[model samples]
Each structure stands twice: as structure tokens, then as C-alpha cells.
Target chain A: MSTSITLLIPLLLGIGGFIVATSRARRFSDVGSGKMHSLPKYHGYLVALSIIVPAYLIIFLWLFFEQSVLRGVIVNALPDALTNGATPAQVSLLISQVQQAASGATFGNPDPAIVEVAGRLREAVVFSRWALPLVIVLVGLATAAVLVSRIAKRFRARNYSEAIMRGLLIFCATLSILATLGILLSLLFEGLQFFSRVSPIEFFFGTRWDPQIAIRPDQIGSSGAFGAIPVFMGTLTIAFTALFVAIPVGIFAAIYMAEFASPHVRGVVKPLIELLAGIPTIVYGFFAVLVISPFIREWLGSIGIAVSPTAAIVPGLVMGVMLIPFISSLSDDAITAVPQSLKDGSLGLGANRAETVTKVLLPAALPGIVGGVLLATTRAIGETMIVVMAAGLTANMTVNPLQGVTTVTVQIVALLTGDTEFDNPKTLAAFGLGLTLFLATLLLNLVAIQIVKRFREQYD
Target chain B: MMENVSFATAGAHARAPEMPVKMFGRKVEVFYGQKQALHGVDLEIPERQVTALIGPSGCGKSTFLRCLNRMNDTVAIARVVGDIRLDGEDIYDKSIDVVELRARVGMVFQKPNPFPKSIFENVAYGPRIHGLFKNKAHLQEIVETSLKRAGLFEEVKDRLDEPGTGLSGGQQQRLCIARAIAVSPEVILMDEPCSALDPIATATVEELIDELKQNYTIVIVTHSMQQAARVSQRTAMFHLGRIVEVGPTEKMFSNPDDKRTQDYITGRFG
Candidate 1:
């Protein structure tokens, strides 16, 4: 059987189960429609779930255990001399290569004995793939047919169907929550491993961050320190600069759109600002590196102020421009949500448009506007591509925007991108930086939500 | 009662009617887009008297009230055609200042819309803008007197620094009234001032309105006939953008001259 045909086994079983259950449900209901409690589709779904859910569970179990069992047998059959002194990761890599060689694909370090064992494993896998899916399909369809044949005029198919549906929805909800918990647990385990190697204090507080590990034990002057302060400081400086640029422009644009501009002008300007947001950050990064930075460098040269070619200011400026649409769109919605009667009250008091906007409208929209700025702050902090391309990877601890800096995310990306050993502190330090970045953004988002909630209460 | 109208007529007969009119509107017509909303409205609003305009929905009663203070100019598509005179000077004249005109003639809306500010600031906004107060104490006095006149002083006296939006709907409406009165305008226009308020609050505002007419010319647009009859000496009924009947409140309700006005007041047709 083809690979796709094998995968189609569960799909066909599910469809057959649905068809049989629905037809039986209809026949049962015909005896007395009032007696049946739930819909026909519910019965179909119940039978389908019973057929596929358990069958897939068994299939997954079998696939997992069978692969391990077969791999163990092949490992045992390997020559005693070859298996000695190999780590678990290296052994797994060797097994993968052998399996590839047996399947008529090129693999590293070809060995005749391993090649022979790989051929046997390949043949077994091909046979199992052909026979296993056929057995599953036949079992699924037969079970569904037998269940449908047992349904009688007195059978509570509808109730049974509803119970199945409720279970299925609950199962889906639980599955998502469990998946989230599983991810968090995996991150925790990795972070714990990172913490064991580098103390949490050194990771968080010690200023000089240098993540370079020696591959060989004989190498001299090897040092791998993961102090995250410089990275965090760089992130804060860039993010603050971006906010300084984005908040005023975005808020003023939003106020002009909401209060001052004519509908015609607003209609034209709103989409253009949104278009600025739609342009990808990578494009902005490109503009920052090739055009903006060069121009800024030349301008600084003319003014007699020395600036690095890849200064943080160019990246901050480009990121701020990228964030303008995000802030403006949110602020516009918040300003527009302010009640019209408030504006009228201020105007009725003989206050001009400017005074009414400043004293009444802006104050009412303050929380929402601040929420938008906070959201933009998080976005700027978590941004990777702009800082990676525009801001140079030298971690400089200075407030000057005209200096090279490296953010945590950019460091994390650089650490893991090249040929990295899994056990080395150099590569594992990325996970530590990632955790800190995640926590910082998470805190920022919570603050944004709180501000939005306070804004809502003021109006509602 | 109808006897009150005759009593005023008798008083006018004895006094030689020597006092000149404070404001006059001539042939006022308002159009929203292509639709004419107010058709040839002409009236003389006497100073320090409450005039109530009563009509069903879409009768241009609110439109006429907005036109008195040139609030209609804010709407991009709305056009006002007529002459409005304040103290014998045409308000729509080329040289006339709209800001001064609006300061002289303050307004109140149907919904109580307090600024997102302290209670004191809400009342102080108008006075501060018009330069009606010279110092802090004078401003405080104006705020206190306006709040007292609006009957909101006792309720909000302790928490003047609290946001005005924290007040109840009725209290907020009175706060808006105090805000209007703080500027010391000669005229105060209200558009359906009690529509969103409860009965008790409506009664309170009605009492306040009766008292306010002693000092300021009050023009109010309302849908409630009883409210108009209770607080207004003169009532104007509008039908389909036209003033169907306008006369003394007692006469207009008890014996309406126009058929449309009679039908409207009798609850037969709107």
C-alpha cells in the first residue's frame, strides 16, 4: 500500500462509523421520533468517535513501542566492538544513518554489518506499514457495522450520541490546556538545566556576558559566562527609544483622525498608516541597514559627532516607524469609543475644539492610549529581525542611541543559529535569555490589560 | 392655568410694555443635507422667561434650539438660513464672533455628559474659559453659586475633587447645568433635558428651571407635555419642521388653534 493509503485507513473508518450510526439512528427514531432525545448527527459522531479515538490511540502506542523494540533488537545485534563507548545521542544518530543506508539512501560512515541489519529493519517496516493499516481499517469498519446492527427500536442511540459529543468537546478542551502545560514544563526543564550549569545570580546580575565555550578540554583560556544584564539593558534602551518615537506620532495621528480631521481626510490617512504596519519588519530592517543607517552615519560625520555605522538609533528609529501603525490603530479605536456626549458637554460650555479635546476627550481616552503604548513597548522589546539586522551584535552598556547594542532575542538567535553543541553552556544560555525575554513581555502584557480594564470602567 | 395668561396680559396692558426684547429670531430655516429640518421659524424670546418647545420626534424642535446658539454650524452638512439677533445685534453677521456668542448663550444637552474631570473642574471649566473669575476664591464662589442654583451643591459638596462621571445620571445632569451657569450666560438652552432622567430627578430639575427663569432666559425643547406646562409660560408646538401652534402654555394645551397641534396634544396623532 502507498503511504497516503495507509494514512487513509482511519479516515475511512471514521466515515463508515458515521454512516452506519446515522442510518441506524434514523431507523430507531422512525419507531417514535418523540422518544429519541438528541439529533441523528450526534449518534453518528458518537459511533465515529468510539471507532477512531481508541483505534488511533492503540495505533500510536503500537508505533511508539514497536519502533523502540525493533531498534533495541538491531542495537543488540550490532557487533560488540562497535557499540562500546557511544553516547545515547551518538547511538541514535548512528541508528538513523543505518536506517537511511538500508532504505537505499546515502548515509555517513557506511558499515557492511550495520548495512545488513538496516536492510532487515527496512523490510520489516515496509511489511508493517502495508499490513497494519489494513487491519486497523477492517477492525474499525466491522466494529461500526456490529454496533449499528445491535441498535433496536428501544435503543437510546441519541442519548449515547450526546454523551459521546460532550466527551469529545471536553477532550478537545483538555487536550489544548494539557499541550500548553506540556510546553511550559519543557521550558522549565530546559531552564532548570541551564540554571544548574550557570547560577541564577550570575545569569541575571553579573554584567559582562560572554557565551563562548571551548570544544576541546585541552584548549586554553576557555570562558563561558551568561550574564544577561547588558542584553536586557540594550533591549530597554532600544524599546524606550522606539516608544519615545512611536507614542507621540501615533497618538497625535489618532487624535487628528478621531477628532479634528474631516471624514474624507481620515478615510485617506487611516489606511495609509495601516499600510505602514502591514509592511514586514524584515523590510524595515533592510531599509534601516542599507539606507537609514548609512544616511545617519554620513549626517553624524558632517556634524562632527562620531557614531558607529550600525548604531542602535537607526534600528530604534525604524522599529518605532514600524510600530506607528500598531499604536495609531489602537489609539484611534480607543479615542473613537469615547462617548459623543462628553465632547458635546465641553463644546456646550463655550470651550473651543482644542480645549475640549485636551481637557475632556484625551483624559477619557488616557487609559486606552496608555494601553496601546504598553502593547507597542512589548512589541518593540520582543522584536528580533530589526535588531538582528540593524543593531550590531556588540553588547554595549550605554544610554547613547548612537552606539552598537545587542538585545536578548538577538543574542538568543545568534547563539543557536550556527553549529552548536547541545550540552555546551554557550548554546544552552540561549534558553535562559529566552525565558527572561518571555517573562518581561508577559509582565508588560499584563500591565496593558490592566490599563485597558481601567479605561473600560471609566466609560461604562 | 388659562387665567394666568389673562393676568399677564392685564399686567402688560397696565405697564405700557416698555421693556425691549433681548433676542429675536427671524425666518429661521435649517436644512440637514437635502432635507429642510426647520421651516421659517420666527419668534421673539423675552429675557428672563422660560420658553418651552414641544413636539414629537423629527419636528425640528431640537434643531431650532441648537440654532439659537449656532450649534448647528458644527454639523458639516447642516445649513441654517435666517437672522438671529442677541441684544439687537445680528448673531450671524460677518463680524460677529461665534465664541463670544456661544459664551453669552450657553446650552445643556439631553444626556448628562460630564467631563472626565473633578466635579469642581467641571463647573470651573466655563468660567475659566470665559475669564469670568479673577482669582481662585472668585472661581470657587462661582462654582458654589452655580452648583447651589442647580441644586447639586448639597449632594456633591464633600467630593468636589472626585470625577464628575462618578455621579448618578441625575446628579451629572445637574452638574452640566452648573457648568453652563458658571459662565454667567444670559441665555440657557436645554434640549430634552429630562428625557434620560427619572421622575423624582425630573421634578427637581423642573423646580430648578422655574427658579433659573428669574435670572436667565431659558429655552427648553422637550417631548413631555406636562413638563412644558409646569415650567414654561410660553409653549411652541412643532409639526413636520413647522411651528403648528405657539402661544401661552395654558392656551396652547387647553385650546390649541391648529388641528395638528390639537391632534398631537390629544394623543391622537404624532
Candidate 2:
């Protein structure tokens, strides 16, 4: 049987169980002296889940281990002459050749021994596919019969269904947390390999960041430097530039939306501002390279100042534009969240709107606003595409916006892009950079959460 | 219809001894969106005395109170038609600045809404915004006298720099009152000011209101007949957006001209 057909048998059984169990539970409720503990539909759901859950679990487990277990069986059944002294890679290649021969798509003339093994592998695969669905159908029928027989007037079907629902929700939650932990562990392991090759002290505190290892000993700049301070500084400079552009404009926009603008005007304008956030970051990268970078160079040149075409300010300005809606939307929420009573108290004291906003609303909403700004700061730090297109690749340790700079994200992309050897220090260094970036943003998010928590406590 | 006519003339009957009217409302009507909240509300607020507006919920008592300082303007859909005058100057005139009008007439809300600032700063905010002080010391002196007048100076003197929101409910209300007083307004409007307070806090605030009437023209809106009777000299009873009766507080509670006022105050029906 095909995999889809195999899966369909459990679904059909579940539906059949549901119909049978529902009618049985309804009969019990109608004929019994006492009331049924749960509704008939809950009984239907309980039986359906009991059949489907275990059947799906078995099918998934069988499918997950089927290929490896089949390969092990095929390898053991092979003669010693065909498999002796073979590396694991060669054995894997030989297995693929056999699988190809079984599928009737052999690339070249095959060995007679391989053809014999391929016939056995084909028989096993066919037997396994048929056995899985037969086993699932039997399990489903057994569970349905047992559960349907156990149904009574006082059966706690609702509690069982509720427990199943809670387990599903917990599984979803645990799945996401485990995925995050998996990524962190992978990064740590790869980063450890990189750190073993490069000293951590030099990687963190040293200023230079040239990661190029010469192919030949005679090559110029042969010894690669791994200092990350310059790269970190560059990241800080660009992020600060973005914040400098985003903060005031974003806050003013928020205040205008929250306090001054009419409902009609706010309704029209807020979505237009948030639309800026919907544009892809790569498009912002293009805008940085084609529009902002040239504009900055020309504008500064007109004022008799020199600047690189791909200056830090290029991507910084575009990233700031990207972050505007982020900061403003969050800040607008924070400002609007301030109690209207406080605004009334201020205005009742004869304070104008400006005084009321500055003296009352801003202070009350300060923590939430700070949290929003910090979140935007992390976004600016982690941004990659725009910097890749507009920022220079050189890790310049400078605060001047007119100079070229590189960031950690840009360096990670540069390191890991193209065909790479897994064991090389250069490729592994991307994991180190990724881990650092992750830590930095994680610390920032924690602080933002703390601030937002305090802010919520203040009012609620 | 006849009852409307009879109650409309009730404000002209049972008048108390003559006193200076600080605020005059002539046929004041308030509308929020399309719904009319107050209809032709005619009343007089005597200078340096508490004029209590007593009614059940949604009877336009609080609406009329907010109209005193033009606080209703903050609600975008709220509209007021008619004349409200402070010291013979029409407060709703196009020439009037709302900031200046609010400075002359302050208000206290039902909920205690002290700014999330220091205790000292909360009171000093008004003086600083209105430039009511010459120097830091003068500002400090104004804050001190305002807090003292609100009867909160002794309690909060040791924690002038602490957040005003950290105070007790009654203390925060008093702090808001002191904030209003710091600007030295001519009139003060209170909208169910003790509704959020415990009995002890309510009594304290009521005593404070009694003391406050000697210096400022006070208009208070309350649901409790006992509160109006205890704290007010002049009382106006509003029912269905019109004045049912306006006279001395004693006569209104004792022998109200309108049946609605009697029904409201006598616990028959509101």
C-alpha cells in the first residue's frame, strides 16, 4: 500500500469509531436511569482521538526509522565479498546504487551480487509498507472496540478529551522551546570548534577582523586577524545612527497619533506608517544602495566634506526608515495606554496640551517607550540585508557616519555564503558571530521585557 | 408636559438670601454626538460657596459640572450650546483661551488621578506651567501653602520627593486638589469626588470641601442626597436633562417643589 493509503486507513477508522461511539453514548444517555457525565459529542471526540493519536504515532515512528533499519538489514544480508573493508560513505553509496537498481533506474551495468541484494531490499520495502497500515488498522480497531465497550452513563469522556487537548497544547509549546534550544546548542558547538582554532581573547578584544586565510604561504596578508572589537564598534555606530534618526521622529509621530490627531486622521495615517514595515528588508537594501547612499555622498560633497559612497550612514539611514514604524507603533500603544484620567488631571490644572504631554503622559509612559526603543535597537543591530548592500565590508573602528563600516550580521553572511568546508575556521567563525549576536539581542529583549513588566505594574 | 413647565419654573421659586453669583449658566445645553445630554440647564453658582448638583446617573449633573471649566471640550464629540460666564465674562466666547479659562476655573474628577510624579512636583506642576512663582523658593512656598490648604502638608511633608501615586486614595485626591489650588483658580468643580473613597476618606474630603468653600467658588456633583445636604448651601436637582429644583439645600431636601426631586431624594425611585 502507498503511504497516503496507509495513512487514510487510520482516518477512516477514526471516523467510523466516532459514529459508532456517538450513537452508543446517545443510547446510554437515553436509556439509563442517571444522566451521562459528558455529552455524546465528547464521547465521539474521545474515541476518535484514542484511535487517531496512537495510529499516527506508530506510522510516524515507523516511517522515521524505516530507511536506516532497512539499510542495516540489507547491509547485514550482503555477502562479505561485496561489503568488506568499505568506509561508511562507500557503504551509503552502494546502498543508493541498490535502491536505484530496485527502482529500475540503474545508471550503468550493475554487479550481479548488488542486483540480488536489490531484489531483497525491494521485497522488504514492500512488506514494510503493507505491514505498517495493517498494524495501524488493527490498533485503531482494538482501541475503538475497547473504548466503545467502556462507554457508560457515568463515563468521564469530557475529562479525557480535555486532558488530550491540554497535552496537545503543551506539546506545541515544548516544540517551539526545544527548537530554540536546538539552534542555540548547534551554534555553541560550532562556535566551540571555531574558538578552538582562534583564541577567544584575541577574537573579542583585538581590533582587526580580516578572516581571509591565504591559500599559499607566499600570499600577501597571509596571516588572518580575528579581532571583533572593530566589528562590534561598527555595529554600535550604525545602530546608534539608526536610533538617532528613528527616535525623535517616531516619538513625535506617536504623540501626534495618540494625543493630537483626530480619530479619522489617526485611522488613515497609522496603517500607512505601518505599511513601511511590510516592505521586504531586501527592498530596503536596494533603496539604501541606489538612493540613500548616493544622496548622502552628494549632499555631503556639496558642503565640502568627503564621504565614502558606501558609508555607514547609507544603511543606517535606510534601517532607520525601516525602524520608524516599529518604534512608533509600540510607542503609540504605550502613550495611548496611559490613563486618560492623568491627562484630565493635568489639563484641569490649566496646563496646555504641550505641558500635559511632557509633564504627565510622557513620564507615565516612559518605561514602555524605553522598552520599545530598546527593541528597535536590537532590530537595528541584527539587520543584515541593507548593510550588506550599502555598508562597506571593511571593519572600520570609527564613529564618524561619513566612514565605511561593517557589522556582525554582515560579516556572518560574508563568511558563510557560498560552498564552504564544514571544518574550516573561517566558516565556523560565522557561528561564533551568530552566537554573539544572539546573546546581545537576547540580553536586550530581557531588559525590554523587564521594563515593560514594570510599566504594566504601574497602571494595572 | 405640565410637570416639565412646573419644574422649569422651580429655579425661580424658594430662593435663598441674595449672594454674589460667580458663575451663571443661561439655557446651557450639552450634546455628545447626536444624543442630547443636558437641555436648557439654568443655574447660578454663588461666589465662595459650594453649589451642589444632585441627581441620579446620566441626569446631566456631571455634564453641567464639566461645562463649568469647559472640560467637556476634551471629548471630541461633546458639544455645548449656551452661555457660561465667570465673573460676567463669557467663558465659551471665541476670544477666550481654554488654558486661561481652565486656570480661572479648576476641576477635580471622581477618580484620584495624581500625575506619576513626585509629591512636590505634582503640586508645583501647576505653578510652573502658569508661571505663578518668581523663583524656586517661591515655587516651593506656593506648593507648601497649597498642600497645607488641602490639609495634606503634615502627612506628605517628609516625602515630598516620593511619587505622588504612592499615596493613599484620599491623600492622592487631596494632592490633586492641592495641584488645582497651586494655580489659584477662582472656581473649583468636583464631579463625584468622594465616589471612589471609603467612608472615612469621604468624611475627610467632605470636611475639606467645607473648609474650601470659604476661599473658592465650589460646584459639586454628587449622587448621595446626604452628601449634598452635608456639604452644600445651594443645591440644584437635575432630572432628565433639566433642573427639577434649585434653592437652599435645606428646602430642596425637605420640601422639594418637583415630584421627581422628591422621588429621587426620598428613595422612592431614581
Weakest ten-residue segment in model 2 chain B by summed lDDT: B1-10
Candidate 1, residues A1-460, lDDT tens digits: the string is 7656756678778887898788777776364456666456666776787778767766777677877877886787677777799998978887887778777897566888778878778777777777778778777877787777766655666677667778879989999999968876776777778888999999899888888776778887648768888888888888888888999999999999998899999999999999998888899989999999989989998999888876779889999999998899989988899998887777777888888788878888988998999899989999999999988787777778888888988998999997877687788888888777777888999999999998888767
Q: List the pairs of residues colliding in candidate 1.
A: none
**Candidate 2: stretches off by over 4 Å:** A29-35, A77-79, A215-221, B1-17
- How does model 1 fare in lDDT? 0.84
Positional deviation of B244 in candidate 2, in angstroms? 1.3
The alpha-carbon lDDT assigned to residue A282 of candidate 1 equals: 92
Error of 2 at A298 (Å): 2.0
Q: Chain B TM per candidate, please?
A: 0.92, 0.93
* TM-score for candidate 2: 0.95
* Candidate 2 structure quality by residue, lDDT tens digits, A1-460: 9998988988888899999999988886354454778888889999999998889999999999999999997898778987899998988888898888889988778988889999999999999988999899888889999999999888899999889888889989999999999999999999999999999999999988998886667887647888999899889989999999899989999999999999999999999999999999999999999888778888989999999876888888899999999889989999999999999999998889999898889988999999999999999999998898888889888888889999999999999889888787788888889989999999999999999889998888
Query: Which candidate number maximizes TM-score?
Result: 2
Candidate number of the best DockQ: 2
lDDT at A96, model 2: 90
The alpha-carbon deviation from the true structure for residue A253 of candidate 1, after best TM-score superposition, in angstroms, is: 1.0
Q: What is the lDDT of residue A390 in candidate 2?
A: 87
